[model samples]
Target: MPQWWKEEIVYQIYPKSFQDSNHDGIGDIQGIIQKLDYLKDLGVTMLWICPIYCSPMDDNGYDIADYYQIHPDFGSMEDVDELIVKAKERDIKIIMDLVINHTSDEHAWFQEALKNPDSPYRQYYIFKEGQDNQPPTNWRSVFSGSVWEKVPHEDNMYYFHSFSKKQPDLNWENPQMREDIYRMINWWLDKGIAGFRVDAINFIKKDQSWQNGPVDGADGLSSCFEFTRNQPGIEVFFKELREKTFDIHHCMTVAEAVGVPYDQLSIFIGQDGCFSMMFDFNYSHIDITEHEEWFPLQNWTMQEYKEKLFLSQKEIFKTGWCGTFLENHDMQRSLNRLIRNPQERTPKAAKALGQMFMFLKGTPFIYQGEEIGTINNHRLSIHDFDDLNSHAQYRRALQEGYSEEEALDFVNRRSRDNTRSPMSWNSQLYAGFSDVQPWLTNNEYYQDINVAKQVNDPDSVLSYYKQMIALRQNPLYHQTLVYGDFISLESEEYVIAYMRQDDQQTILCIQNLQNKETHFPLSSKAQVLLSNDQVNIQNQQLKLSPYQATILLIE
Candidate 1:
């Protein structure tokens, strides 16, 4: 049951912001190749690069125009081949972002389908006849507005798009289309890439009955999630997808399954499951009331967050595995989200947060700038943002009668663009990400938090990440740390504690989730393995510092 991916530590690269070679102000394959040694030194065993396929840049590469060709902005096929070979040389495997749930409206198939109603490509996407001059169903797109877009010159015809209008949902019900997707996946696997981080995979299957769901928002359209996400009979498509592609090559697949419930974990990740693992957003989105709207933030306590995480861990333990992470391209930085006080978001706080998740009983994923403890960029204007979803949310807030300033503040606090800012490599011009201005603005604090500042500093967040990764990969505790059973530990209100245990040993991880000192009982036989701050222990009682993270081995 042991798998190589299970033991490997993954580092996710948002290529467009990672690095730029040739002074083009755009990050490309060559830019990534230049960072291989840096990743190797950081103790990363695998790299998950976001989509770099040919596209019109509608959804920042998620909307694929050509699955077979690399986007010119990223590089050519030869460059990608070089990247794979180079990464492999450094003991790092690369997994691409597989976005088969939808394709760019500019894709050849969509174009062909748009040009002729009778084209075979027409079946590749979902098209329906309008109902009384309205969309077939009142389903709201994930990005906002109606999920249907009227087709020009085609009488009463509309196409369904789950995310963006430029991104058309592929008809998974189409047998030929499914086979074509399988072939494309096999082609990538054959090219020597490891596998994929499947994007929007849960939305692939939809309700066969096109009926309007109960409207959940003032917009009168129901959240498409009710009818499209993790729908019934989705297992058939999942089974076929696995058997046809992933199983044949034995490639690692992690699905972005948003709406899957705990009771259904078995169908997605165990021996008979569809993927190797899946991301659980229950704890990650604790601050938000819903994934669709950004306003009216939900208040969450450390105890509540701990319970949500423990529940996910317990459920996933029964059926399959999970990918533990704090920040990614889609959300605000971990430091910003976890620490409420802007001044308290320091290197120590970042290390504390990183330590909380790194040693869990699952493969840990480090986002591109997370190792350096990057915080969210604070841009004042909405025009300074690039995420389409941010614009939609701003509009939604206005429609709900919020002031422009209030709406902008909500977007500032929750925008995906907060994490999409260019990665800070050095303190030089543009943070050494590019010779010219980056496509997105650099973080204002990049000068103080760039990788160059902490690469050699042993006390830095970057160094702490390297230490955690080394400990996980160390043969001394690899079996216990990588495959151990996760057990929630009883702790105080502001503390998140857990134990990773096996027959050989038990490792206890305790983190103070707030900026206040607390106390926890420690066993006399426990040996300190790691701590983000100085430890003060006396008479079986340990005094924890503000935002402290401690790992101990029980002998």
Candidate 2:
């Protein structure tokens, strides 16, 4: 609503797996530059590249070793400059991933903090003494083990990490730290980067009391939910951040916010709130269990999924816009996760999901490989796993009286590594991601679902996404899709319908969540704008096929 972001279509690229130009077993900025035309042709207005900063890659690129330098695995600073220039030439805006919540333990500041107790950098990160030889708080690391790790040569003192021990949480309460982060943000904006996808930003602030919450996991440690997550006064930091950096350059920011309450939506993404939009995790959390394990997920019904997604859309429709996405680097494939019936999850189903979200009153994001309807990684042994979270969960599964094979299967379904696999550019070896062995294994079905195979097929999932994106950005419909009022429609079971209404025109979007044919009332004559399956209006009723998604303009 503030500017052009509402009309933008973002495409997320996991740099390490996107494409390897150098064939160094890793993707790089040059590869992205080479594919800029492809993205532009697909109607991608903006690109969100995951962290390519200098890092140890302990948790991929989230653990930054240096904010100013580009990781060698990604490319040189010159390559980044070239990417920005090339992307701009193709009218594609580049959105950097902002991961300021923490830094790698190998970072200079953290290294300095470890060696010198009285150094100014010591206060840059959270470090405190233990109580009775135990950790200050019984908090569990998101990756695994205790959140507190003993600082070498510092008697009984330890540092806290919300994620892996290698990624230590920064002390945002420190004014110098906040100033440094602001400076870094401005530095990137000054370098022609359009905006940022702020990562784990909600966890920047903490309660500081280090009080233990109710133990919820098999381990004695408690989840960070009640203790360190979404503490009071985080808005103060957000406000300053926007004023000092984003506001100056009018940069767009989408935050990876978790645990934010519905009541405070305005503070986080209001007219003048923290970011342009924050990811709504209500639907993403639908599959997790009470013990926070993915093996024994809660039974999720189609009605529940619809209600959850609708609640998010309806809430953000008030003050700000929603950032609608089905899959990202952190989650499983959208179609694979949502459509339980493997037999019914055809290319049509993926297109239906794509159309349903793209037409919604929000900016739609297409993750790499998502356009082609890639599924999750196949069964992986513990030896083949790379993600720290997956390793932790697999170990937990084994401890929960499950066999090794069972644990592997459970982790296979929920591991973030599923999304981290190399992008399938073609049917070639390594799916044309790299000439050498990729950092991770490529999905096996790349032979049938690669971009090279789909780009020419008009009925392919990729082609459908291109059409959906083009339509969303079409001159005649852009205003209606971007600024129109969102109205939830309730007509039939196993169907989610909504309307985007503007003064000039109204568009109706309907999707059949089930794998069976269904019918919905359609009184007036309507024209099919876009649909996954062939459906027509007859006798004042619309016939929908299995997993159908239809958009209609009323006559």
Candidate 3:
């Protein structure tokens, strides 16, 4: 039986930049409520909203201070309740971000842990004694710093954090801490939320050895990922987590699980797996180096990207399911990343990329502003950026002997802020995202690419996405589009072609991934179902224009 979640299309909303209702320059629950109809019109079944919990806004609400309270910048709990009820009315389920891997330093548990080393709360977080007046281990944080931060006025005491210093890593080794996390999860599930998008859940379990890894950069500190990401015993915690919370509530879960090997796919996402699905970052991070550094972007070919994506799809198809996403809060816009030629970054190219990913054998996720083909933001200076990771990358690039212009260029091409820009609803003062200045700068191209200009236009990227969604949801072809096997078609390097096959029908999706025309042999029985451009089919040969994407149903 096909799962409901598998057939559902998800839309991710980064609350801060989605829309502002109170003119407070920050997006809120009310703003989301106002956009419910828009999402419904876009045909998404679920909304995976980023964290809106009470926080100091460190890491943009990922450093949660209180799981029970809503962030003031967003709105009160009443607003959230209204949003849930309203979104449900629109047939859209809400999925909140589960960030249990860590908590804000200001969280009561962490504050108590810091106040007295002997407090029971101290056991809730990881704390270690320093050696030789230095951090216990030489592990580097994800945001480019030592993972250990020394305790102020305390003798040789330090705490562990995988990301920001303000976010303390939770000690899953403590049974009590695990119980608390499960309880909190259940509480939210009981509130009528459909599920959760688990954040960095793989980093919860750490290697007990606490050994330093090989230093891969000039910082001398080793990457903490080896010591904390997807360790041996992590499955135990995952099993427990599902049994206690998700399993009981029958909630859908998609994990942001990096470093999970192909062999472990069944354990993480099958029938007995911990999550319903997981996001595969193999193809998404293709432009970056293996170390995930932003500077000196790695050169990649279309074939390489195709191989990575195909491998992931094939492996996951063998075990469980996958979450197909090209853009997220943590990634740059897909239009900017996928289309190499800036001149080809048009509505046609955006529609081509959208159609290419929508029919893959998985649940599709569309990030905010992705429907209208949002592109990367090119800020003039490093000071203009807001993401902590961007600043870290800039400094790291400089430390690696790159000039300021080069560092900013790298940031421009890969910064998370590129996708974090306020959604361009209209050509109003702040791109219709807010009445006043938005929390983040509006993309300069909003004047031409805003939703208001494309909402009703048949040729717009937004309209094309709606058409693709409708095609997927159509009962006549739903079986083949949703549950069919993915078979990669052998084609030229620049052309990506695949067939989704079932016992009844075969749906072929092909794309010209370059800025030049291409030719591919086509079956005479193939019928055009959808296309981004005017494809020429003559004499059993299909002529594809620049960046053309087409879908055909083979009779």
Candidate 4:
């Protein structure tokens, strides 16, 4: 593992909502510059900003129109250069979101591809002749509907899109296209940024045969992932990617690689692996379903959640590292997902959840508002939604006989919009995010949960995050926390206990996930290193308050 990357605590920023410096109702590079001290003080060493490239806003900037330029809404390339320099001054690193799986339809390459079938750029994207009047395949896009979009003025010709129609999938089978992507990545690295959080990189390789996949949905369309996800030969692309870019610069790379074979974990993150680490989604995906439908989601029992977390940790620790996170721009807030009971989702519980993951055997990532314990926005309507995936799911629910209210409830619970809401910096105008209206509404609870209210409070969730980060980066416990072996402890329902052991020390971390106080047996000698609540210790026993968590240094 790269020692620097392993020691990092990455903070993800959804650029459009993080902070609006120009008051244009959108966050920008300048906005990020304005908040560097805040992040530095929060104890994060790396910043992973989601796509801020030139785009048509399809998929919220994931659909890139220009790789070399920053989106105007995000400020000029000069602002980005300034951000890198400024961040360096504070000893922080910036990791860009590398999104080469697809490009916006408005991109010049795609536009040229549309004008003529024989254009040189045509080979840059996946375009094929349709069978009769139907699409070339039965695959469904991730955003919804058919994966293929017909070319205008062309007979039975279509282009494939794994996501939105406005975003056309790139043809990784084309060697020139791969070279182009590599060159673009190296160009960015030359600009002095740390590296990239590769987006949907696992989707780059496609099944050589483009045959239709088995139907798995009511729409008669097969999931594109069924045929293309983590397909064979994909590793070849990554190996080359690393050689041409990351390996040369010795930069950090965390891949968003879904459906990777468990046995092949070493190939993805080992010392000579393609990436420094890869995100493990098993824990965050507990509420999801295989059918891609939201309504039939399952709530994780404490055991189920713990099992998933343990498995991922154990597997990754064998050969390489993992990127541990409870929430990102794509998922609903962690507090709402982990603590289902509304009343149980308090700041104290949030702190416990944060502590549980930060000390695990991996790099911990804190999303923009995660440090402040942001919860899902429960009040939302179909009309107020902007996320294409959420809007598609809402329409699907209505067509499948769900009541309008029920469908809206599902959207409220599952929408990425829940995390896209502008950061609540202060209680004032636009939660101190902007002077004008934000692109999306600020969370209603922001008035009480804003950063200004918690930044100075000793007991705030923000403060607890600082404490946890400091502990993880603390010189005294650094080695044990980062390289220790994780051992799970047998405990009752609604309780999670684990130990991190290195050559000379054992750190026991315990948490009560429920609202009721629980009695825990103390089977060893220990001293408190950290705790979310006041604890009572009797003769070889521990009495833990509701949602309490503690890190104990076992003697």
- Model 2 stretches with alpha carbons more than 4 Å out: 290-292
Computed on alpha carbons, the lDDT of every model, listed in order, comes to: 0.91, 0.86, 0.91, 0.89
Candidate 3 lDDT trough over 10 residues, lowest sum: 1-10
What digit string (tens of lDDT, one per residue) describes model 2 on residues 289-370? 6435676656898788888888888887777767888889988888778888777768888888888778877888989988
Residues 328-347, candidate 3: write the lDDT tens digits: 99989888887788998988
TM values, all candidates: 0.99, 0.98, 0.99, 0.98
TM-score of 3: 0.99
What's the lDDT of the predicted structure labeled candidate 2?
A: 0.86
Clashing pairs in 1: none
Q: Which is better, 3 or 4, measured by lDDT?
A: 3
Clash number for every model? Answer: 0, 0, 0, 0
- Choose 2 or 3, whichever is better by lDDT: 3
Question: Alpha-carbon error at 315 in model 4, in Å?
Answer: 0.9
On a 0 to 1 TM-score scale, where does candidate 4 land against the true structure? 0.98
Best by lDDT: 3
Query: Which is superior by lDDT, 2 or 4?
Result: 4
